[model samples]
Target: MFMDLDALSDIIVLKHVGHGLTVVTAGVDRIELAHPLTEICDLEYSGMVTYAAGGSSVEISCKVARARDEGEPSRPEDLLLTCIFTMVALDPVTRKPVAIPRLVCETPDEEYLFQAGAARSLERRTERKTSLLEVAPDDEESALIHRIWLQQLKYRDRSHPLRQPPNVLAMSRTQLATAAIMQPQYRNRHQTMIFGGYHLKQTFELAFCCAASFAHARPTFVSADPCAFRSPVPVGSVLYLTATVVYTDPAVVEDDEAQDKINKDGGDSESPALTRVHVRVDSKVREMEHGTARVTGQFHYTFTVPKDVRVLPNTYEEYMKYMDARRRVRAGAKSHRSLPVAGRDGPNLTE
Candidate 1:
């Protein structure tokens, strides 16, 4: 079961399904780096079907772990990354969701996994309705917004070198973007649309750049929020990605200028200072015949940097994005606190 992800083959063949039908990721429910991979080592990967809905949708759980010696069983501590993905079969020509075979659980463990996946899926749908994007800022968020606005107003004029604090940056200044044509090589197994993994890679790279720029230090990835694919990008279409710092969790740190001076007077510090950075990437696609672009995906990434930094929203739109990212960060922290690290054992087949 441990193998290269791309080499994995389909386990189910729906009866009467069209020959050219393709499967696509409906959403990435979660992707968390449980621990860092600090050294070069052989990696093992495994995945299993956790749940299947009435029609085409199914939930899959995947894990990446360090390869163990022969005859040694995998432990939860071996896991490096854990992911949950929702996928659906689609008609190639029409790009519509297609009905597929229903999953038949053959064991009690399988049934448990099925039920757990169902509950998580339902919770995700329910949570979307009341997400930060759909609701107005609460009292505390409003106060935070006003405080950020006041800080920016006082430091708006960069013409004077001392006006802006070194630790704070305008959200607009942290944007990093890229655009590309969806080439034939990027097509998925369906051969009709660009691959979802390709899109994820693009977004992650740009988000990393945005975070690094904002923090002025190399950033280490911590996690990624649930990312939804709104539309499939057809081969030959234009894809545009924009990544920016939407939130920052500033931690106590010595002044960067003072720290640099200390390092210069003495020797470099043994370890780098670190703080959390949140970056969001928005993707849009435009076909050759269309004059406008349509949103295709949204990705949020969390990283840690070696310096204290803050992102201040200077505009209404930026404020909303900032709030959305803030809410996601808090939600992630709460979820992690409730769940056991890795699992009681290793990655659970029933998770």
Candidate 2:
């Protein structure tokens, strides 16, 4: 179910010795090869994950990615290597990923790992079918939710305790969306699609703006979900990345002493009183002519705020977003676990 990352060094050896040319593996996604062997090895897909159904026709994304030989590359002989965090399976097949590659697992445990990933992809697809932001011609549930939110505005008293006072700090949903398009140059030449890492970085940048504004300060990087590259963002497509501050620290109100101390000390580097917020980002894209945005990726982040800012959700929709964020965070905490890999960027599950 889990492995010491050091075992990958041996597995990489087995690849050259003929078990398989490529290691079909489930681990932290990184591209590592031996020296001199690195000459023609200019592919820089660090922490990129590709997940697809076993069926044919896997589409890869080519959005917001560009080739840059900026970071150090890994070699087989390197004493310590990154991206070997969690090895549930490995594939030795020699073929390249024309479409998304299916797991060519060697054992039940390996298949088990791959299956779990596939299941997650499926679950995301199902959720995307009717996300709150998605527009459908006849989506009754979505319409109902919207109507219910609107109805609350007419019936609820303005002076009620359920809503934030007019003078309280708050954030608007208006600043949450950014519109952009994917270009041909963003894709990998060989694969003709965007690298997962590139998409992730770009998405994080957008989320940072939303989180920073909502937190009223710079937020510390916590962790992100292992990318489940849901679908490809084709070249020449418009992209809409929505970053929502779903939840803000619920503590700063009750413990003014600690909040004041943190505010003064700037959230002591390791202090538990650090203001925290959960931000969720969804990647959506559509054809240049089409108006509807389909979900491409789902990412969640937890950041510790450095300010004593207050985020009051003033409306039904805003209130629901806060509550939903809290629920998801709770669910994630229940199922999350971490493995101590030697050189991991982020754990497959959580850190």
Candidate 3:
């Protein structure tokens, strides 16, 4: 669905979402429900379909991207939406849930979200602050998204589920990408201003490419740091984007006994170990009139990778970037280690 980011931002500013609660709609389509027998998400949702099951939910997190470049990426000066979706299964008879027999979700993805949610609350309550370029993985936005997902998941049943391993960190690999985009085609659509999503989209694409190429694997889109669009790119401005992989390392640390046990079971030793890649992106818009450049926006991204992958930093710049990424990751981890909010802002809303 087409989401209005400007509208969402206004809501966030107003906190019209019932006391700091934000529910942004994403352009996410439901693929299909997990089959009751095999629990496979193999079907795509086409219109005019019938659900033989009970009520279910697909939770998605969406943010507005600027759509000024109507050439390749069409837009009517609109908010381009990016999304992360989660699906839960429901039963047809009792209108309950069909519990999928799986291990406990110790996946770094889930753990990070749950723990980071608390960590963020602690940071906000403590001394930590944030910027567009650097964000703790477990920030308020992450917490909000994760909380929605966790709430949706609670509808299902879990009994004696085993635990899955967290993602690994990719510290040895370093990646970089730079690109320049032409000005908007639909000048009338924007009238006299540039859309923020256009620049944001360029930076995000570069970051994604850098991460995906560096890993030599598909990088799942996780979370991105906030982009305020504080500065604007002028009309006829050529936006230049620089994307790089700053930090990476394993996320999980198991005890010696647990490690040995997993090793014996052919876990990380056999299966590729997962890692987290932190990608930072910055954009500078070239002003046509003054021939000067101004920083328009910056963003940070988190993606999963295999632990065996090493992103080595050869240059001093790369090394510093790596250190910076590590610092952010550590900060995020710290937030996850704090006392989580029972619900939004600390009070238990359910009561």
lDDT leader: 1
The runs of at least 3 residues in candidate 1 whose Cα sits more than 4 Å from the true structure, single-residue gaps closed, are: 1-20, 92-94, 106-108, 156-163, 251-273, 337-347
The positional error of residue 335 in candidate 3, measured at the CA in angstroms, is: 1.5
TM-score of each: 0.83, 0.51, 0.47
Q: Lowest-lDDT window of 10 residues in candidate 1? A: 1-10
Q: Over 4 Å off in model 3, which ranges?
A: 1-7, 10-178, 185-190, 226-230, 251-269, 337-351
Write the residue-wise lDDT of candidate 3 on 224-300 in tens digits. 54333435565666777777777655411213453344334433466666767778887677766677787765577
Q: Order the candidates by TM-score, highest first.
A: 1, 2, 3
RMSD of 2: 11.4
Q: Which of the predicted structures, 1 or 2, would earn the higher lDDT when compared with the native?
A: 1
Off by over 4 Å in 2: 1-168, 171-174, 189-191, 251-273, 314-320, 343-351
lDDT tens per residue, model 1, 171-246: 8999998989999998877777887777878888899899988877899998888888898899999999999998
For each candidate, the alpha-carbon lDDT, in order, equals 0.72, 0.47, 0.43
Tens-place lDDT per residue, model 2, 173-267, is 42588777777766632244454445666777877787787756787665454444556676788878888776665532334464345345544
